[model samples]
Target: MHRLFLCEKPSQAKDIAKVLGANRRGDGCWLGSDVTVTWCIGHLLETAPPDAYDPRYKRWVLADLPIVPEHWKMRVKAKTASQFKAVKRLLGEARELVIATDADREGEMIARELVEHCRYRGPIQRLWLSALDDTSIRKALAALKPGAETFSLYHSALGRSRADWLIGMNMSRLFTLLGRQSGYQGVLPVGRVQTPTLRLVVDRDRSIADFVPVAYWAIEVALLADGSSFNAQWRVPEDACDEQGRCLNPALAQQAAAAIGNAASARVVKLRTERMGEAPPLPFDLGTLQEVCSKKLGLGAQETLDIAQALYETHKLITYPRSDCGYLPLSQHGEAPAILQALGRGDPGLAELLPHLDAQRRSRAWNDGKVSAHHGIIPTAAALSLDRLVGKQRAVYALIRARYLAQFLPNHEYDRSQADFTCAGQALRAVGKVIVESGWRRALPEALTPGKGRETQPAQPLPALREGQDCAVAGVTLKDLWTQPPKPFTEGDLIKAMKNVAKLVDDPRLKQKLKDTTGIGTEATRAGIIQGLLDRGYLRKQGKALAATPAAFSLIDAVPRAIADPGTTAIWEQALDMVQSGEMSLEEFVGKQSAWMSKQVQRCVSLRISISAPASPAAAAPWKKKRKTAPRKASASKGSAAGKRAAKPTSRT
Candidate 1:
């Protein structure tokens, strides 16, 4: 009577196998006398194709669409049939089974689908593993949960999969057919998530294209105080300043600068110093890690995830890389000192931090309830040599490790000094920061750099100052400025927008729903969703920013407003959460989606579409080469109203 373990992938399978002492290799699994360990290469079975529902679906036509399967079927993935057979055999033999997949909704789907497909009726237990280190693995094994505990997660993931398939299959066919009627041959791929993401880019491009740059001016004053000189800016009074606080009248700015420059002395009106303390940043969640890597290391979103996966799966240096939470469980707090000691021993650069590592100080990151399925990504005790990682891998590891070390350090303390002065009856202000205690910043020297973009408050340390003290206004200059348009979406910026989608929404209920949900996609799938857009030509690289192509604009315009709204994902997620909580049934959710999809298809099928009409091109980078255009010709017959494309939808990237 053997107990069997089923894991999501081979790397994960091997990790669990080592803990179970199932070292001997069999057909497609590891075997020991008392137990067997096996894995599916991420779902050996997938939902059957539309053709499986009916043969007529093999051809793409409008009438044949709205293909809803009555009895959903899953077939073994052709490439990994052998592994499926091996797992099936193991399931048949075991008296009891353990599900050892990644501890998330998708992972639950991967394992549970197989169990139902294999017709297994054994007592099922769950091994929820967040980290692969020996200590974490053993701790999880000692307290295995019953399969019923996570069964709702499987339903949630299954609901998402089926919904995506319905939208992808039906909508792609319907739109592609519509485009063809207008003589456009390119396939118009639409997705529940990708469409909204596409809309985000499309909207941003429109905002940029329509932007009218407004010119303004400001006055700069250089002052000398107590043997130290610093520059400050003249503050425009209420009557002189524009809505954005820019001096709209250039002459007024010039007059102010001239008056201030002519003044020989100035008097300090007020001085205030406030002490501020900042805790270390929370550790890396997959989204935050992807954002930082995209900005600092110049890595793509998928590239960052790939590097992180390698660190987790191949090197066993860090915990699971796909976690969404940035908080760690309080239970893991005791393990910090050992990890810190090992880190110092691994790199001489970290040796200086060894003396300051205070394990007793608990930051806001250590909360038991805040953590879900998995905690934040962190270094595992198995990590020894940083030398094993190179390039992006090494860079990401360092970032993850740095956040862990910072939690033990004291709060970063600083003195913020603001000096207000009067020069020739003009108000001028200057602000400076003085480090009171380096604290966590000692581990991160780069944090001290001024003008790091996000922190627009320039750190100009000032010398000792006194209220009502006299100072000389050495010089004054007038500077011209223009209100800049929004920049294109960088992957980092996109990730942030995705996480904070709640801000974009207006409907209070939907906004609240989005707050409860992660952005448009899950952390595990966001990178893939982005890569898929690039692959399909819906989104193209205009240098570093992702811009929706003309094709993308047309597809988004062609779709119903309900489908393109970012809030759609929130509503869907709300229902899925209901399924997870048993407030809604999976069958009920899918049925509702089918009804909604059917309404959308019927409402849209009769509409005429003409893609030959031009679309406003996304704003171009300065370095982009100008494209050569063909002589203007008459558009397709029964085509768009004019050669000029419609004004794009309003955008904010």
Candidate 2:
């Protein structure tokens, strides 16, 4: 063959091969005159385990604490070994090769590792593709990059893999052995990313356990003016209030409630009104999409990712779904009219919105400077019909489309008014909000819009009144309540926490490094990382909430703080970015990781480890096999007065 195309998966290969006119199918490949196309099933090979280096490393022992490999090795994954052989055969037959994998670091590693392993010496080129649609593919084919340009991405990916192996192989063995010595039979798996994520949950659970409820009081007064009524809250004096401005003295609140109840009217002391405008939110990156899906659709992180991937790959309904950046490239703006026109044609439901959309309008989301490896997830002109999509797929597609449509609409405008009143020698405040224009909010689904949930009160509009106007007192209600503990992490909340973990760090430098790197895991890998923790029994689910198991708590307490610190992981990521930019070599980066791994092993070897064991081996295993039926939604039980009052009536008013 004169040319060969190497793709990441069979579906991707099929799509590209059709465009290349490689119609005939060969064994694990497609055949064309003087050209061929072949694919790998994800990664054809994985990093060799420790046992592959030496037979002696099979048994877990403290003496072999740090197992550093002088020469790294790659072993063909047994499951896909046959496919690997076919690719190797195709590589040897081709005169020239093209890499057409996913456009990211991990994808680069998947293809480059094979090229090096197969010893293919030929003219090489790279295919930078974002979408699998015909137009996108053909455009990319016309402008293939030289192999040397993306060589750094392969090195960066290699550095990440080697660092992960260094930590996963050495530290996991070190901890498992220590836990065994302390009479814990369960295996303890530690990772550079997963461990830090587990730490977040463990810390949150502990905070909830250690929290003490403090009693506080609040009074709500209803006032009437010209037959219209509004609610006002009692303002506590500075001396008798807490840091949050909650009233601390029960006697003072009771006295104020009674006085307000007996009073005839309240004089408005001060009034102010201001116009506010909120710009449309940026489009969904992977992390933000997963968070919104979990909150609005009750879907898990992995579940949301699966749906998004299907939309991109199978349905051809959206652009690449694994992007971390939410901003669109300015160059892509020219295609908006075509895509918007396609949406209107495919779905008649969107016909009404078509006239309102101004394809020429550009929002802040269209910025070339902020575009990263890929742009935000958006709909493609490839979509021909929305009727083919069902259930969660349709719901997710609606969300993505709404965000795109929002960019063409004006800002959501409103008027906010605040009024201060004096009644029975006590200070009171009333706040009201009125919408001047629905604007971008018109594109949002009612369920996804603001004020849909019971937790968030609906906006109230107050009657027009002068500063010195006296409003008649309608009624007064005093409430006694207790502060609530922090809620457990949902998958969505955990995803958000992972993205913004720098806020929890103490050191300024480390914190900034984390913020710059966008926290512990990349957008592409975070869902898988979280799923691994769930599969390993490190985290448990209580309804929609997530809590760390006892084994998880034990592991967190036993490990070195640096191993569990998200900031430390962020520093490692910063170094990887340096590797990608050619500021550091792969050898130097792996060397530092090895040295650090050795120190961690040495420091923990002499220490005693204690772990909280579960009642049985089966109990400690992941909660996957026997699925727990979802609990019925209800209010707090009769015993928890504090829980029942978690939603304060005064806040609702």
Instruction: Point to the candidate with the largest TM-score.
Output: 2
| Predicted candidate 1 versus true structure: per-residue lDDT over 1-653, tens digit per residue | 47998888898888888988889999999988799889989889999999988887888988786999999999999999999999998899999999998899999999999999999998999998878877888999998999999999999999999999998889878987888898876567779888888788777776766666677887778889877898788889889888867898977888888889889978889999999888888889999998887777778889999999888888888999998899998989988878877787778877767788798889999999899878999998876777777877888898898888888999889898889999888999888889999888776658421123533456889889899998888887787776676676767667777767788888998787678787788889888888877655566665566666666677778998888887887678778888988999999999999999999999999988866333212111112443554323222211111111222232221
For 1-653, candidate 2 gives per-residue lDDT tens digits of 89999999999899899999999999899988887999999999999988999999988888977999999999999999999999999999999999998888988999999999999999999999878888888989999999888989999999999999899888888887888888776667789899999899888777766666788988888999999999998999899999988997888999999999999999999999999888888888999999999889988899999999988878778888889989999988999999889888889998777778889999999999999888999888887788888999999999998998898888889998889999999999998889998888888976786442321225689999889999999999898877777777889999988888888899987776677776878888889988878766667666677767766777899999999998888788889999999999999999999999999999998778887653224434432364554422222212122322332333322
- The C-alpha stretches of model 2 lying farther than 4 A from their native spots are 450-457, 614-653
Per candidate, the number of residue pairs that clash is: 2, 0
Q: State the displacement of the C-alpha of residue 206, model 1, in Å, after optimal TM-score superposition.
A: 1.4
Clashing pairs in 2: none
Against the unseen true structure, what C-alpha lDDT does each candidate score?
0.81, 0.85
Provide the lDDT at 140 for model 2. Answer: 90
How many clashing residue pairs are found in candidate 1? 2
